[model samples]
Target: MKNKVLLLTWSALITVVLLASLSFARQGTGLIGNVFSDFNDFSWQLDEFYDIVGPTKLNSIDVEEAKKNITVSDDEIERHRYRYGTLADQLSNIHDQYAQRIADAKDAGNELLMNTLIEERDMKLADIRKNFESDAHVEAKIRKEKEKALVQYLNDVKANSFSLPVAYEFTDVETGETYSSGDVSVPAVYKKQFNAAKGYFKANSLPGHNGTNGWIRTSDYGNQAASEDIQITTSVKTFEGTVIVPKSAVAKGGVLYSQYKDFNKGRLATYVFWLLGIIALITLLTVMKFQKEWVTGTAIADWYADLKIDLKAAAFFMTALILVGYIDSKSSNLSNFFTYQSLGRWGEWLTSFLIGGVVMTTLFAFQLVNGVERWKREGVLAKDIKNSFTLQFFKALREMFLKRSIGVQSFILLIGFFLAGIGFIGGFIDGIFLMIYAFCVLFLGLPALYIFVRRSAYLNRIIVATEQMASGRLNEDIKIEGRSPLADHAKNLNNLREGVRISMTEQAKSERLKTELITNVSHDLRTPLTSIITYTDLLKDENITSEERAKYVDILDKKSQRLKTLIEDLFEVSKMASGNLELNKQRVDLTQLLQQALAEHANQISESGLDFRTTIPEEMLIAHVDGQRWWRVLDNLIVNAVKYSLPGTRVYVTLRKVGDSAEFVVKNITKFELSENVDELFERFKRADTSRHTDGSGLGLAIAQSIVDMHQGNMKIELDGDLFKVTVTVPTK
Candidate 1:
């Protein structure tokens, strides 16, 4: 905060200094312009260069009388006398010269010569003492002085005295032909008038009647030179320092230019400098505020957009500048004010600092209020510049271009044809303008329309593909062209189509399996139910033997038990598949659970005459799981192995901890040929043997897989020809 304040102070000071400099510049007061004056003073050889306008009025003077009018202090008079000979010494030299001439003339001359010398000496003495001279001599000296003034004035006019340019124009009174001064020429026909004016001038040198009309300008472009003189006058309001209003008796034709109006350039310059300083200070303040917005962590373009400073304010400034220029043109008084007036020197120095300080302080104060408002508004982005251009063109292109709208885009192209027609028709009337119009239509209009049309066509391809996809037509993928956004969209669309096709195929396969499951389930139920019904009907015969009745009863019990087991297995599998089974999860010893399951199946193992191979780990393999559901997985695997294993064949069972999981493996020789599609065993009502020879529902493996899934474990059935293997893994953590 302290640094920022300090920086603000410094900036204000700097701006003030710059503003003062600018004000001085506007006043035409500058250091470099005085370099020549300084050099002239320092140089040993004095410059005698002087500028004068032609036909200047020279002052008439009597030398002795002028000397008496002069006043000076004795000290200054002594200083001037030491540097140059005084009037006293000049008078003394003149007196001595006359006295010597009188003596010499009397000694060497005859009476006629001495008489002439005596009269000439007395006359010279009277002329010097009383300032008396012949009328012819006085007139001659005045004329000579006037000639010198006239020459100096003319030289001043040639070099544009006081750095003022005087533009000249001449109009022939008889022909009404106005000519640029650079384009006019003196013609032969004017020689008569020139001589007549000269004669008139010699007749009377007092100068009132000594004037003649003359051509003012010369030309070299053609032979259209002036053959006669013309009466001309300057129409502009100003001359260098004086204005010569023709009707005001200030200037006469070919006579003398007299001062009409005079204005001090230094006084006029003051108004100009003030106006410039005021304006510059305001502009500086505005610009400073615009820049300060960026210092408070906001991006520059964003702040510009937020404030509208650049877009609106800059345009206003340009318009104001142009307006001021036009206004200045209509008012010469205001123009003179800018051209001449200024504060001398000290005020210029002070104004610089004042301009800076005032501008900076004003801007700083504005930011204090406006900066808080910036927080409430979201800033603009770099992308907004592009968007701004797009919006600017939206009116022209809105009806057709953009948005992949092919119809609208093509319509614009159609309109372009008519625009082109108008352009061509316009061309014959005016080549330059119409040709420009034609190019605008052909290049700008046609190209813009075509660009949108091309984009629309690109977009249509995607639309067509999307429609086909909605209609369940996912055959061919859409093709892409170019490295534009549409190409990327096309690629994604193609991928979507492929994914939908695969999903449909998978759905169809699942439907077929569901249908097969219903048919197999019915068959399995009918087989067990038939046995129970038939056995119960046979047991109803009164004449049947006890042994026969007992055998039928045993068959009934066996089929009924098999049907119950199948129904239970189907229900469990369905529950797991539907995700409705609630689990009582707890830390259970997987090894102990495996041992208990083996003990429950020991009778079946012993009766089957199968050699049981067990590889149970001694350490507890603990995992958070439903103990009953996990045991069921083990039971199904053991039962599946026992039912499918060949009689008297070796049955192998292994259980161990594998990394973070508890794994169980069961292997046996298949009683029937096992198919290569072993994964089908996990499907409901599916088995290795198609015939219902085995006293087991095919739901065992499916139920085991479901229970394993419920426990978030992995179960797989592996088959190597007649060898069957099932592996189950459950996470221990």
Candidate 2:
């Protein structure tokens, strides 16, 4: 609250004071006064006075009214006194001259002459005393003298004014050479008339003398009067302002001009005041709002965080400042400075530099603070930077310069700007651009070039890696470098290479498994066929015993049955894998199916010497699937558990609803040690036992997994220690 009041008070004080100053200036006698006085003109001051006190005040200042309060200046009084004193002396001289003339007449020894001379001398002396003794008489005398001068001046003007332009000539005292009539020189008194006479010579070809004295005719005048010279004479008149008008009126003209000058200045000051008042109000309101944090945090603030200060920008700013200062320092040309007794141009430069330096330093301090704050705040929320300018610089260098593409283009464009700068600007600007070019080449160029070249090298590696992969050699890993796009591409390429290698490895494994499957099936089928063939051959032999014949027939039937089952299992597994098996999907109780399968496998479980550990939930776990296929899945899992569980080892079968899915898990300890390669057990002719000893076909788990997949269920196998666990999850909805 106090601070707010203080701000308002300060603002009010400043505004009031400035307003007062502004009013004073606008009255046209403050700032304007100083400016006018610089040129020795106080006209604006008079203007201010007249504007304040209008023509009414001027009209009020009558001569009689002015005389009542006005005192004459010393120069005027002294001049008038000298004039009065000289008149008194002139009166005394007149007296003395009259007395001398009186004495001369008296000395002629004629009574009449002496009386007449004495009378004339007395009359003239009295007249002189009367004229010189009183100011009125003196003023009248001056008026008469002016009247005489005016008349004489008019007469001279009349004499100089020719009826028509006529040639005139004058003799040259030094050279008596005949000269062109207009070319002849004259006294300053007759120069005007002489110039007027020039048109006559130029207008007419004839030279002759006119009837007027010294007026020569142009017709034959130059030829006939070649040796003749005419004399030139005239009187010239000059006048003063005081002679044509009252001293007061002439002074008033000056006053009026001054008034107008003040009016213009007042207009200018008015504009300044209006702008100042507006700015003051805005500043106050802005400050109040800013103090309240009304608009503190914004996009600009965030952008400020990304702002960075550049030394080159500062240097350019200073360079511009120096140029402006130089221009200002040279405000007065060298010639003027020297001729007008001012400071030397160098001295002016020094002074202006100091002043400009002070102003620029203040501005620079503000800018530097802002720049530093921005630089500091840029990485405030960021990592890999420790809030030091140096750290930030290096970070930027690593990210923008050393890395590649994204920032390398900026460097390229910057170089291009300078390279193209010569076309846009010439002279000093071109030179400066050249300097920038050299600077960039020396500093930024080497690093940028390295980045680009390194980027190119990475690209080449990627290309080569791609070509190798295209040619079926995809085992190589592409080297990853910077965090640039090219590096990302390299990483992707490396992943692709690994993927391709895995794919190719899988392909080779599949081929090997395919060969093994063919070989194993051939051997298994041939063993049964060979038995059948031998039995049939034995049956064909009539010499064999009856029991032997019966045994051969049973053997043939058993081998045929085994061959048919294996072929059927293979076809079912193939159909399931090829996605050709369709399901009559419906919501089925997974728990019930699991229990039923467990019950059916109970006899096998009992015979196999494997204990059953069942945890089938009664809460009715349901799954959307083919009820028959789901039963088969349970039957297969149970059968496999019964077959694979070691004697006295428990097989766990659990059915539960987890979230929206039904999970059925079967876990067992294998009777035959389960191979680590459990996935191969799902392939045809592959089993835990590499030797064809297990009676069950290897397609049991494979068909179950395929049925689960057809129902959009997940089947997972986990092997831990001597335990194998298979989990199947089917969606309920």
Candidate 3:
């Protein structure tokens, strides 16, 4: 508690000192103009004061006296006469002006108006001709106009000279007489102490009439009449009295003056420096203490960290705004020192700065303690931004743009929809707009209607196709046109139709296989059982020799064993079909396994009069499989090859690595034609010997296929006329 109190006290004190320094820098009169003694000066202030007071001695010109001396030359008079252009062009201009008006009036049957316009044109032309013929009359007319213009110019000059509250005393150097305007008794403080004359003057030359030629020349008459020219040269007057402004003029209403006064006379600069020095020392001590205690132990830091993410973010944003506004306000106030304006409220500015400084320091400390830690504990800045509502809205809007086809189509349709609606309404508003409605219908509405009809027809076709597929007719595929949503749906329906067709075909094949399985099982199992029964009945006939009885007993024994073998094979095959067969798997050399299978069938291969050709890689090809199950697969293929190969034909058994898998292939010419579907050879109780005369269960290939499937291996049978081939592939370790 003590540490917390001490830290807060020290921090608040630091904030106050910092804010005071900022305020001093920002306030125009506080630092640059007042506290900074080197920059403080009074000369500029005196100059500005004199400007406010304005010039004292005013000059006037006598236009009548000056005009009497203005003489117009004959050449100048001639020039002025034709100033409007040649007489012929002048008459033409007048005619051009009234010709259109006169014709329009005549066309309207207003003869009086037309005659009036013709008379005006004729009078203007007559004046132009008269000026062209007479020179003296033109010269007199030009002189009168020059006199009138000079009088107006002088009158304007006098009207524009502003009267001031200033007093002036002028003494004539020759007469020793004094002329005064106002009181002419200003004090020494407000006097404009300057060596130069400060007043308006009259000249023999006219204002802006100095040129000898061109339209800008107001008059050259003064240049010609040199003798009568009354040149009013500037005269010097000796002024004895000092000009002064009353103290009221430089009071509160005149902020610049007051500020200058404070700038010159105020002596608080040393005190301000000492205060800042002391504050700096205190800040150093405070910083040293803070380095030891930091903000982690502060209750405020804890409270800030405990705030909800949104509330904390708002606090951070508002703090930033306040700091920015405070800095901008201070910077603008500081700039005002160089400008001539009212000084800001120093006390109010200081107070606001202090408050803002405290808030800034508090939030900065809190941010140091909690902000980075919180972000690391929660999520990164990207995650936070991605979760923001504004970003999410923009992300969704970006996705809308990313789907360009849909967005473009939707945008075009929306425009067409609105345009068509507007056109429909416009048709009722005006007859001319009826064309717009028709144009929109032909260009926008008709195309949209056609697309809708086409899509609807396509949808109807899809529906019909689906109905046909439901009724088990899946031959036809729905036609897909464009990359539209409807087309995608149609594609999906096509795939579903293919899937359904395959499912139905598999169902029919399963039914036929089930019937064949029952028939084959009945024939194979009953044959052995019947032979055993017949031999047993023969042994039961006692009227026979011992040798005959023994032979009969041997026959019964052989038939019973065959029956047992058939039943065992049937149970094993059934177990494999039901997916209940378990195998002990291990890494076995497939080359060696194949060699062992072929070696076991060597006797049969030789007895069948078939040449057995074995090909295997010398290097070990290892595979992860159940040793006994894999051996069974190999044994079945070799046995079938030896049994079914045509007499004196070559049976090829090859084992080699193909990429990442081991391929064991067996090819031979079958002794019998495999006219049926080659896929049906893997069925139980089905074999190349259609007569069921071979002393073997027909479950060899079916069991082999089941075992290969369980081990995630592949077994394929290919038949070409009398040629039979089997390929078994399995992944090698």
Best by TM-score: 1
Sort every candidate by TM-score, greatest first.
Answer: 1, 3, 2
lDDT for residue 205 in candidate 2, whole number 0-100: 11
For residue 286, give model 2's deviation from the true position in Å: 66
Task: Give the clash count for each candidate.
Answer: 20, 8, 1
Task: Provide TM-scores for the models.
Answer: 0.37, 0.36, 0.37
Score residue 20 of candidate 3 by CA lDDT. Answer: 47
Which regions of candidate 1 are displaced past 4 Å? 1-471, 475-481, 485-489, 492-515
lDDT of 1 by residue, 1-733 (tens): 5535544654554443344454455433432343222222212111111112221211112233322333323443233233224445545666677777677777876667767776876775564443232444433433333333333333433443322112224333334343232211222111111122332111111122232321212121121321111122111111111111123122333211121121223334444544555665675566433444434544543454464333434544554454344323322233233333357644653453344343334344444434444445665333344455445567556644554544454676678778778778878878886868866977797679677778789899899989999999888889899876678889999989889988998899889988988998999999989989888888889999999988988888889898998888878877888989999999999889989998999999899888999999888889999989888888888887777789989988999888989888998998887669766777889976678777778888888888788778998877787888888888989
Worst 10 residues of 2 by lDDT: 237-246
Against the true structure, candidate 1 reaches a TM-score of 0.37
How do the residues 570-596 of candidate 2 rate in per-residue lDDT, one tens digit apiece?
A: 888878878787779887787777778
Q: Each prediction's Cα lDDT score?
A: 0.58, 0.57, 0.68
lDDT of 3 by residue, 1-733 (tens): 7655654555556564554455555553554443221233444443332332222232244566667766777667667777768887888888888889999999999999989988988887887787888887676767776666556555554554322234445453345455555554543234442223563221112222221221223444342322122222222223333454444444567523555455443335434543664776577576534542555656776676555566667778888778667655654444233233234655665567556755576555556556776576655555656666667778886786675765666667788889888878989999879997897788878888787677778879888888988988888888897887778888999999879977988999899989988999999989988888888888888898899988888888887888887898888888987878888989898878887877787788778888888889999999899999899888888888877788999988899899989998999999887865987898889978889888778988988899889888899999888888999988875
Best model per lDDT? 3
